[model samples]
Target: MKFDFCTLLASSLQICYDACCTFRIWNLQVSILIFFSLFLFF
Candidate 1:
């Protein structure tokens, strides 16, 4: 039972990390676009 719980928790953490990484990448891309557009406008 303990081993099963640990395995489940580990897998959940891996999934969460992946999701966070994807969100971060998306945010970075958006920020870069905004930066470039602002620079051009200014």
Candidate 2:
């Protein structure tokens, strides 16, 4: 029972970590695009 719980927790944590990394990369791309657009506008 304990081993199963640990496995579940680890998997969930890994999934969360992956999601965060993906989100961070997307956020960075969006920020860069916006920055360039504003820079060009001015």
Q: Candidate 1, after superposition: displacement of residue 39 in Å?
A: 48
Candidate 1 per-residue lDDT over residues 1-42, each given as its tens digit: 254645655755565566567786655555555556546644
Per-prediction RMSD in angstroms?
15.6, 15.5
lDDT of 2 at 23: 88
Tell me the TM-score of model 1: 0.47
List runs of model 2 lying over 4 Å from the truth. 1-3, 24-42
Position 38, candidate 2: lDDT: 48
**What value does the lDDT take at residue 33 in candidate 2?**
58
List the candidates' TM-scores in order. Answer: 0.47, 0.47
Task: Please report, as a residue range, the 10-residue window in candidate 1 with the lowest summed lDDT.
Answer: 1-10
Q: Count clashing residue pairs per candidate.
A: 0, 0
* Structure candidate 2, residue pairs in collision: none
